[model samples]
Target: MTSVGIDFGTTNSVVAHFAAGSPAVLSSDEPPADWAGLGFDRVLPTVFGRGLDDRPIFGWQAKQRPGSLAAVKRLLRAEERAEVDGIEYSVEEIATLIFGHLKRSGAAQGVGFDQAVVTIPANSRGIARYRTKLAAGMAGVQVQALINEPTAAAMSYSMRSATEETLMVVDWGGGTLDVTILRNVEGVFMEQASKGIQKLGGLDFDSALARLVLDTVSDSDRWTQDERTGFRLDVERAKIQLSELEEVSVPLPGGQYRRITRPMYEQVIQSQVHRVREPIEQCLKDLGGSASDIDALVLVGGTCKTPLIRRFVADAVGLSPAPGIDPMTAVAEGAAVASAILGGDLDDRDFFVSTEHALGTKVLNPNVGLVFSELIPRNHKLPARATETFTPVRDFQDQLQVEVVEGDPEKPLDDDDNVVLKEWTITLPEPRAFGEISIDLTYSYDVDGILHVHGEDSLGNVVLDEAVSYGASVDKRELTRIAQRVSRTLDEDRIAGPPGPSASSLSAADRQLVNDVQAKILPFIDDAEATQLRSAVTRLEGGDASAAAELQAATRQYSYLL
Candidate 1:
């Protein structure tokens, strides 16, 4: 059984595992022919797109395809489903595809694995964590446990030394910013606190730069989908280049160019960079410490590579990123180490993680309706159990409804940030007056991060006890069906020969127009119309002349929107 660790990131993903008693990141043995100028072959781009065959294409192959989905982890935070090329897929299904790629990629490097310890952002709610695990399971990858990204990075950095230091990790990735404060003592790693700002990261910087480019370039209103995609790629590249160079010229359509200086880039993203300080301040507050008390600051994430961010961290913490840590791969490396620890390979070390959010139940109050009552407060040490006693507000209450929620304890019950993980109905043995009977609600969070809740009456009669489920549970049958479909898709990808020429004689420009039209109208049109358009696009890709005519008709019908 090979112990594996997977970092399914927002912008890129990596797979690593233990090799010869040390963590090793896996990479493809042979690079693709078109790998030139793209990112390192080891890091897979988190993207999805439709191929010419109308099937999904992933990773770098999806980069050129118009309308490809990128940075989709942000979508998984709040969405249950997403549409790709007129095909609706559950968010978990999309994640399954990514995991499947990592699984195969790892195998190609002679590290075949079926299970892994996956990393997630420290601020992830119960629903997102559940979906991540569900996706991994659907991909035939058993997730042994979930670890926080910042904690994993800190562990990876700390494992190299036996220093007893207070470390703060500032993990600003593509989609989120997480800050963790902890102490590494001897071989035991204990987390003190964690705070984060969601939906604020590298992608936001890219968007801001893209806006700057569009505002400077002329005829921006007439840009097509392909041009827009090309410009987006260019903006991302220039953002990276700006990190090294003081300025770079971003090429525009029609042989034009726009110059972007580092100062301008920094100004545009200054607000986001400032938001990073909030989590750090909050974490310090939770720790009851100041920046002067920290021994070192560990910076991990591609976004942290920007010079401006480094300067900001140095100015804020009065320290540089801990020496010798690869910002891009630290989290994955840490995950591999954690995989070893969880697999019982590291008996000398005691690794402990803390709860990211407060876990409790909603209680009715006379003044504020339903309010959150904390059972296990945020940053509490894990493998923890807490019991809170409650009495019915009404006389002769027949049953107790336990609304298990997770969120900031300061938030109101109706606040959208407060997520209800599960709800339970405990039938009372007999109707009793509110003041006469009391029920004890107990919550236990295990080391594996699973939560269980139970209740009992004053008479010691067990009312309800079960593992608390987070999010809406998908039927096992549905999961199996999706898994079968995914298997068939992978099989087809393996055995299918090279693609044949299209049946239609439409020129390249005509085909692109039809694609643009389809992309333009799919959202506004009805499902029936969308289906017709999808069929036309598939036929057009297959060189169907009649289908080109059908696409032309639909294009004419929806020209108003276009």
Candidate 2:
């Protein structure tokens, strides 16, 4: 069976497959003449557009549209459908569009991979990874394996380089920032430590650039969506130009233009530039070493291409980067190499899976009330399973809420913001606690990188055991509808049309805010309005505070009292 590793990135998605003796990225698939009008390349954009079509329009085909959207990867756990133009679409729907684009591109090269491996950020744990797998299933390719992005990159590096050395993989892409430290022992790549900041990426850089340009304008506070979007596009383009040129003049809306030199550009995003070093520093700290301890620094992702970042990481790591592969395709190439290994094509050696986040439950502390307790710590090798026993504070506790979150277990678990995986409640027949009954939470992470959670009584009876739930996955009809939707995209692939647009990002902390605010307000709005509110909340929660605030005010002012 043909197999490939898919880096379904925040900004762009790439596919690489095992071929004659090695893995290769399908980088030469250019859009057809008609598709060329949509403005695309080998790297499929992770975006969807607003339209009247039954299926979502995506990538370049989404450009110049009114309701064009991007960043569905970050919104995977979000249950609300985004309304663009007059249509509404779920997070899975938008993701399916992106995956479908990848399928079409692969098929264009006469390679429709039946078995595939999809890679996600090391921080993309629990439900986020499950949603990724679901998206792949929607695209008609059964996932053979799921690998962390940096691990796959390391696999790629080990494949090309025979020399054994300690190397660092800094994968700063459009939506997530992940760092992995690994060693090539003989031929096997062993990850020593890993860390990530899911909310940080290229989109943040774009937004910061937007803020810099907007600051030069008088009505920055009152800027409309159209105005913000236009500035975003221009500033984003100029930022890309600054990477190649010493300086770039960006045209802001309202006939304003400013010259942004590399130094000036760096200054605008200086705070964020410093933030990039955080995960790297933290990873090194976890390894009990300094930059000098790192033998070679491997840079991957488009944002890592910026001269300022490359120079800073090189200086910070105290080592010059190894020059061989393009940073942009490094992860895709690495994932491709991993796919080959998993497919048993390359028997050089093997790699291991590491959990990106701590897996645990929220339990009542004797003195502190409810707090998080971890069963599996971050970076633990998989397939990992762990169990912890606990008893209720009350003599007779009728119910137990088993909320398993993927985050810093050291942190106090206050709300859903601390969760990335699953949350389920177990109801007991009668009041029982302490000696009356013993509760055990069992977490088993499988080979597919999926987690199976189980709660049991001391008698060994299963209380709750299942995969983590998706906001929309609970509905059987919804799952069927999504499957049908994904299948249709394959059919649309044959039509040679339906390219549209989209954007990227996500984090754990915001989950709390969404659960509290959106749920209460949902009953007040219609389907169309609810979709818009969700997109607005997703944008606002994703650091688009401006758009979210404006929409909130507009809703309050124009409401017909329900």
Candidate 3:
């Protein structure tokens, strides 16, 4: 059996195998026939649908269904839930459906994979990762490891390069943007840190263009709700066209249409482009590295194929982006290379993986109040272990709370932020006195990067020996419930009504007043894009007070859409 590597992406997924000498992509029985013909041989859509019997039909077959939800990537949130034809599925189930397709595809290629490596965004949280692992388990594949996508891309790039150098891998995939700084130190790849914007990607840019098309129709009073939705779909096509052509004509209802220039599309998407840049700036700052210090800026992902994206990156990074590597398969290829290394099949070629952050407990001290004594330090090598002593504040204290936290100590304090407290309130019994120093907390990370926290007192008593897995935080089933409630709430609000009439919808006198304000604001609006101007107009026209609040939440959840 051969070891396989999978890049289970949001928009599309691919699998690869290492044979003879280099990693090669496998082929899938799906559309985009070229997916199976190129050097990166295998690629498949990640969409999956449930049948009446609750059995999932995956890949192109699932996507071919009428009204099929094609972008299952956005639905991967731990808190997202969906019901298709009265059958509910968690993000993990959908992922499993896709994985099953890959498994069958691999089997079709005459390769039975036992051990496999998977790629994920570097900044994926514990829950997202746990769900990914569960999805792999459902597919019946033994996950040899879960490597960061950019790290894998860096490794793949490093392997082809002659000189050892530090490079920044900008992985702007269909649904996510991840920026990683890596050092190829004498052939050992070491990842510094990675930052990501989950909602910033090709989809958001498409949506922005869609909105611009919708605005033109709305202005003409020719847009029905259905027509608006159709325009949204047309916008995606127009975006693809504008990417290739300087200008493209997007057809509207009644045989009428508007020509959109690349500059116009860029104007619509400028905000999203800025959103992608912000994270890269933060990632570089966090790494304490300069753009000048980076030996190269390597772009990976289908979205990176855009000329505007390439130009922006080249301008921002002070270096021309690399060429010749297939953005879509680079990460998957890098993952195969890493799998080869772990299987003891590859030589000393460096690629970076994010440092394993330690999970430790904080104890209450009489003199110090609460002090964090780390059992495992951040960036500790994987499959590693460390033990630490925790003394009770009181001599006979029977229990201690082991607050497991993951993050840099230097992060700003925010009382409302949950990221500040990654995990807390894991308790362990203290078997002896304070002077006796009764409990020992041991933290270890496995090959898959899942954490396990174990504790025992001075008497060799085990207080807790449980896996600190993602599913433990919340039931996977509840995620769908939360999502349903959230979706319903949003729909209800949308149907309730707009706050007031717009200037175009107002009386002539009122319109004049609105126009006076508009005259004052139009210059700023012209300088700003349509979306931002629309927001300002909505607020000025006394739109719902909750609009800003709702927008803020959406912005945080999908900041890439800004």
Estimate, for each residue in 222-339, the C-alpha lDDT of model 3 and write its tens digit: 5565565456556666676665789988888768888899998888777677766776786688678778888988999878877888889889899998766888788888888888
- In candidate 2 the C-alpha lDDT for residue 360 amounts to 78
Ranking by lDDT: 1, 2, 3
TM-score of each prediction:
0.80, 0.80, 0.71
Encode model 1's per-residue lDDT on 449-482: one tens digit a residue: 5676778889788887655543444444455556
lDDT of each: 0.78, 0.71, 0.64
Highest lDDT scorer: 1
Residue 10, candidate 1: alpha-carbon lDDT: 94
- What's the residue-level lDDT of 148 in candidate 1? 87
Residue 294 displacement in candidate 1 (angstroms): 1.4
Tens-digit lDDT track for model 2 on 343-374? 78778877876776777777667998977777
Clashes of 2: 14
Off by over 4 Å in 3: 32-42, 51-55, 64-77, 219-233, 251-258, 286-288, 348-352, 356-403, 413-439, 471-562
Q: Which segments of model 1 are wrong by more than 4 Å?
A: 28-39, 389-401, 411-417, 422-440, 455-472, 491-562
Task: Show pairs that collide, candidate 1.
Answer: 502-543, 503-542, 503-543, 504-543, 504-544
